[model samples]
Target: MRRRPSKEQFEQQIEQTAKALHDEMIAGKWAAGSFLPPEKSLEARFGLSNYSIRLGLEQLVQEGWIEKIAGVGNRVVATRPQVKLTIACENVTLRNLKTSGAGRTISAFYPWIQVEFLSMISPIPGTDLSERTLAGDLVLLDNVQFQQLSENRLTHLLEPLSEDDEWYPQFTKHFSVEGRRLLQPIVLSPLVLCYNKAHFRESGLAEPNGSWTWNDLIRHAELLYDGRGRYGFAFHIQSLYRWPLFLIQSRERFEESGEEFLRSRSSRLLDGLKLCKDILHNRKAVPLYLSENNDDINRMFMEGKLSMTLNTYMGLNSWNEAEIEYDISPVPYMDSPRTLLITLGAGINGSSEHKEEARLLVDFLGRCGRERESAYADRIRHYCKCCAQRLP
Candidate 1:
């Protein structure tokens, strides 16, 4: 006399039920030798039908949360999951980042979703035409790295997310290809001015705020420079992440490349480029030594080698526990007020056999990422399929 449970309803009940029981078990929830509460009690407690309760219990068994005894009930078999989840990644983003706040959260929470989270990441992949990108159950890439995989390749490699628009509308849709979603965002950060507060206090210069401009920053840099070991401000001018912000804020679609482009809104582009060049060559503004990459900038900033540098939230993980007193502010803009926002996201491999589990990871990260940073992850991906970005 019970009605049928819809597939959607059944799946939701199962996922939620498993997560709840998993939490309880993790908290030393069960009594009588870690035996799960009676199925009838679980059914009533979770508002799930008897069939739904059994299905939820079955998932836990499959996930190695418990073992089913003959004729009695399900009992704890492994305190930790015996499953190993493989995810294709880049070593720099995850392995070196475990010490950061966001990175630490990810490292800690990865076990919450699954105990044996195995990662085999390639440091840098070549762009050989014949070379194929080998993958596992999941792959994570930022917007810039996503370009390494061609549009057709990305389309073939990723599947549409089960839950569309689970994060911010802009980020949610950023992973779509040809109106079909291909990934979900997990973490994001906007470019901000990371500065040493002590330096500003020592020099009697007011800390930078939202109203700072290029000229203001340059003038302050001249003052902050000690002419001994430290400089005022420094960032890698050659970084793909740093250089592009100049052209983007210049505010032109930039289809034409000749004088026509320069005559258009591209004049701002020239100004932006000039500023970058001046900053790089400005002896009074930057350090004598060159910065190789963003990591170098972060390290020097933490060591008090420089007063300020442009960085993203993800980049802040390096200094999450640094003993220095540092704060972040809006990056000084040129003619237009804009900042480069970056996001790192996860996608299920199109051909992965364990796609359902991958979806669970995507969903779990999507839900959890919102808790960590509600608004900054994966803000740019599919929006500019051809790399022609429109202001967000």
Candidate 2:
């Protein structure tokens, strides 16, 4: 008997199938106005079920890569001159077609950009998309990717989008190179302390505050521990986003690998490393981080398994429906309140022939983050496309 695949496995198969078909289309395997391979042929090619093949094709149709002809088949949309804009996206979560809000946040921006233009949005696989590659006319990028593309000269230096008086000047400067701001910021969040207030009330502990120090966090965390199945403090300490918190706090760059990093002479850097080390080794404070992704850590926070953890606004996207009581505060400071910020923005591909169209998309997406701002999520509601998922 054939064994059934897990949900994750099935989703991976769908993404692989979608990416396989997308890569082929972009590489010009199938000519314009031609119908894609039949479902049976695609099934054999990608080793997916008929349903999975249909779902994969459905994603392409939604992205405008193909159109379904009644009673015929899905035909590849004609390329270029007819369509003024082409969008390239990163599969930050490998989910562009899901019905849920979290899955569709990034995907929903395409329709607004597609207004009055024949456009296709391809969520290029992160592994397949390189630092210097331009998959489409306009690319949706995060802070890091935009900077990388800017450094490599692959992104169009959008002259008109340089300044918005309301935007954080420093962040706007981060996207600029040699007097030209390249990408427009859409959504951003700084690392903050997220705690289960119920846990604090139950534990008779005062809530966290900006004035708290690392030593205070460690002490409160110890008190917060109930010797129950839950851990008082924990995070996916190995995450790139999490691990760097220590170095950034120390105001030092521990940029090295192997023996060189291990033998670094920077005392301030070592001080930060020691903090992370203590927390990881202090089993009474944090649990063993054996699980994958921030979701594993986030699940603990959501289910009341963790009392407190460091998080960004994006991590709380699902908290809208959680029954648990929680609150946010500035992360405990070591030396100062300086914290890491993560931003998602859009950039125009330098090679894009349709510069004006690309600008419109960025303008619409980055237009305003503060209009309906909430105490919890600053500008998240508008750009996250969580107009469907309301935040408290």
Candidate 3:
């Protein structure tokens, strides 16, 4: 019979549970006003009593991390503060000035210089102190991202995509974007494919190279299968979105021309679905179902039972914390090496009272110098670049 966890073990489990919930919030898995799993279900999943689960939920609620409705259950309340902005402006150049010319008396000779100064500083307002601009209501205008400057209103919301027929016409009309500044663009990191080095060696298979393709993956999975209890590969169904990385690797475009320009070709989508079904059914190389209810894959990986799994870089961090021996490779490709990327950004609400401050925060993100930009980049770098192919 299996042994029950000791008191110390139980405490550790509670900590792990709390950390998982926190990670989910960071990933935007739980949106605003969405309730998490019920306490009873959580208790079963964590192998704890109702009281222990309640304690964890209560801690989240007290920290303003989440809010508990009278009958609706606990919902994520706290989101990351948008004091910093992340922007993409690869072509624009900015100028730096040590002192302003407001106090100095200037003659007509300064005409050209005055025009240059005004041209540089006119588009961006925060740099000029003499101008009668609203300082608190800072407004940052990037290509597609924005943020608020106020401390109380720090939620990062994404701006609706533009509907310009030139690019995405439907989106342009949806957002009513006839005349609006595009926020700065933010790049997302690619999902990573991870495996256990020790397991590979023990099974007499070579460590997968970064250039391995989908067929290579299938062959490796076949070698690793024991056909007794554990499977060769297992991933959560919800994470199937990453399958597009394989299609990209194969050099297939996700979109094609059609009356409904946004609609995907059924044949291409079927091919992708078949690939997953083959891995899970035809070859029986992976399990068809693996509940993330309690992070079952994570448990299996930590226990040294799983040979391979595909997940985000953040998932790798969890494996490291659990002391699991593993290595990460690029997601397998079909023709070219590519991985799906998921980017995030912040925006000010249209109805926000602190519009100017929000704009300042957004401006700071895009136009700010290297120091601030690097800080933001470093925060999420670990999860952003595992085996990712550069966009050409």
Highest lDDT model number: 1
Q: Candidate 1's residue-wise lDDT over 1-392, tens digit each?
A: 98877889779979999988876665446632567878999988998888888888889889787888978988976455533455666555654335234334544544433322334444342132111343657777666666555543645667776666456666756666667767787776566788899999999999998678888898999999998888898887766667777767666445566777658554666777777888878899887676666778878888998999987667777676798998988778775467776767788877776565567667766777677663432332312222234222
Q: Against the true structure, what is each candidate's TM-score?
A: 0.71, 0.61, 0.46
Residue pairs with backbone overlap in model 1: 174-382, 188-377, 343-378
Error of 3 at 65 (Å): 31
Overall lDDT per candidate, in order of appearance: 0.68, 0.66, 0.49
Model 2: lowest-lDDT 10 consecutive positions: 383-392
Instruction: Report how far off residue 92 is in candidate 3 (Å).
Output: 34
Question: Largest TM-score belongs to which candidate?
Answer: 1
TM-score of 1: 0.71
Q: Write the per-residue lDDT of candidate 2 for residues 1-392, one digit (tens) a residue.
A: 99999999998899888877775665457766899988889888887889999998898888778888888898988742233465555544212211144224433443323322112233322222453345566666656556555556654443435466666575577677777777777666567788999989988889998788888888888888878778888888756556667777777655567776776665687888898898778778888767676778888888888999987765566566789889987777678765666666667766677665566566656764433233436434322221211110
All candidates in order of TM-score, best leading: 1, 2, 3
Which is superior by lDDT, 1 or 2? Answer: 1
